[model samples]
Target: MGLTQTGTYNTRQLQIVIINSILVVLSITAVSLRVWARRLQGLGLFVEDYLSIFALALSLGVNALLFQSLHAGVGEHVDTLSTATVEAYSLNLYVMQLFWNTCLPVIKLSIVLFYQRIFPVRSMIIACRSVMLFLAAWYIAFQTTAIFQCIPIHHEWQKKTTQGKCIAFVPFVTTLAATNLCTDVLLLILPTRQVWKLQIPWGRKVGLSAIFTLGIIVCAISIVRLENLIAISNSDITWSDTYSHLWTAIESSLGVVVSCLPSLMPIVRLVKSRGSRRDGKSLTGIGQGSSYPSYVRGPYELSEVSNRVSTGPTRTRLRAGSSHSDLIRKQAGDIEIITEIDQTVESTNHSNNI
Candidate 1:
């Protein structure tokens, strides 16, 4: 059955659909760039990357359910919808909740896995694994609870039936949101100590820490979503739930986007490096038959030049310098800032020895 219209039949369903549609597109783009960045560095796709892809897939599923719910009159007043329309909306929402619960924890796990990849210290790795295990348990428990929340699961959508008992929705949802918020905060703090211990410049250390903690934005969105969920009323639930769904869409899509921000850094640096190379080439007339060899432009070029002209100890020094440069480029490209820092320290020691 189609949505019924009353004298006061205003609906925000279109707004929800439009906002989520845009967010889904953005999330897709972010994940694509993350994959591209890895490929640019010649790195293989890691567990975190695969997990991100999975999370994005689940989020897409949730968005599809959301659109279906909206089409079934999810943003109209309950009284304006026929019983069948309301049932359809409720069924869609029920399925959406399961997807939502699954998608969010996967996003967090992906982030945690990324941390484990970047920081290989014994304590840090242990902490990451512990968090990952906890998240797995959390996801399983919540998904199971969501599936069987009502004594007869069909009663969740077939609200007119009074035979089956259901758990209190608000309390269940509030507890889930609260635990999710706690995990967000934990993940935000997990890497801070390690970041501070980096041997890089204090400014760079702070910048790196900030990048790792970008999940704070997701945490803030989670808080807002929890508040919105709490304020939603059962009366006119179809209309009231629209705002809740809007926040859910924003939170899930933004989580994927934020998780991807660090990986996108390599692309930014690659673009900037290309622009710098172009400017240098123009200023020096390097490609226009200048006296200097074309291979004198940068570290990679210098390494090639040195290989042909240098000898003995000079050759050793040149090769060492070239290796250092290569190491930095590869580490930066890989988005392995921690390894980059360690290599920076080792490169400094090697320079002093030479």
Candidate 2:
């Protein structure tokens, strides 16, 4: 179809295709990295991983529906399409909104569930559960409203003059956007304090906290989408709402990718390790003879425990193997016997899954 208002070609579908394509690719990469990280750690898939997968699947459904709507002339001028085409687009758009609402909350819950596992502090876990409950309630409320937004849902697709009463679009969407922003803020703050209390250094703690804080990006996108949503009117919904559509797709897709990023820490550490070895540097995160969070140490199969230093100049070691323990005992003679403590701190730091 040709452009109705501009001198340039109508590139709505093209833009949608490109954005969704990139998003799907990133989603796949994120999940792949999660699986790889899990295999490296020798653990089964966990709840949060399944939740992320569900969210990704819903996102794909939304993408496909949006593309189908475009084919039905959703992004073009309404005058350019037949009555049947318009109806098809309307139905598809409604279905897309259902999937969009579902996808956003699932992704949020996945991240929150992850926090529950990683930070077992009683207060933090309670906060995480509270947020999860809020998200679940929000999803159901918004989805139900969306379904019945108009009296006789089929009227949602009717022509402007023929369409029956529907709730005010601006208020409904604004409420949705505001709730989304609220949740984003809550999720961002949920783990910051807990992470701050970690025994790690100031810089490392900040760095770790920043990862959880990345939800602010989604909040910004939601604000942009709300702006576009407010601009939408009965005058030219399909055309005017294009920006809102664009941001919605972007926000949901970006959320999915960001949610999975924390799970990819193991792969990142591996790359850093290889680079460091090639440069002839000592391996960091391991055998440093200094205590560090196991997650920072990267997911490794090694079973070596660090030697713990006491208050004075004396130090003790934890031995895993009995034969080696005997050899060390023989060598040290009168030295204090090193009690073997299992050095494996569950590396679920990235996954935070039990």
For model 2 the TM-score comes to 0.77
TM-score against native, each model:
0.80, 0.77
Candidate 1 lDDT, tens digit per residue, 1-354? 323354332447657767888988989999999898766544568788998999899888877877777667777778978788888887888888898899899999888888876777899999999998999899989999999999799999897854788898878988888899999999999989977886677888888888988999989999998998898788888877787877887888888899889878757756654565544321111110112122223333242222111112112233232332221221212343321111111223333222
Instruction: Estimate the overall C-alpha local distance difference test score of candidate 1.
Output: 0.71
Tens-digit per-residue lDDT, 1-354, candidate 2: 323455443677668778878877887788777777665444467799998889888887876776666666657777767778777767877887888899999999889888887766799888988888888899889999999999888888775537588888778988898888888878878888877776556876777777777888888888888888888876666777666777777888788888887777656655765575444332332111134112222233222333232322212222222111111111110111222221222323242211
lDDT of each: 0.71, 0.67
lDDT of 2: 0.67
Clashing pairs in 1: none
Q: Which residue pairs collide, candidate 2? A: none
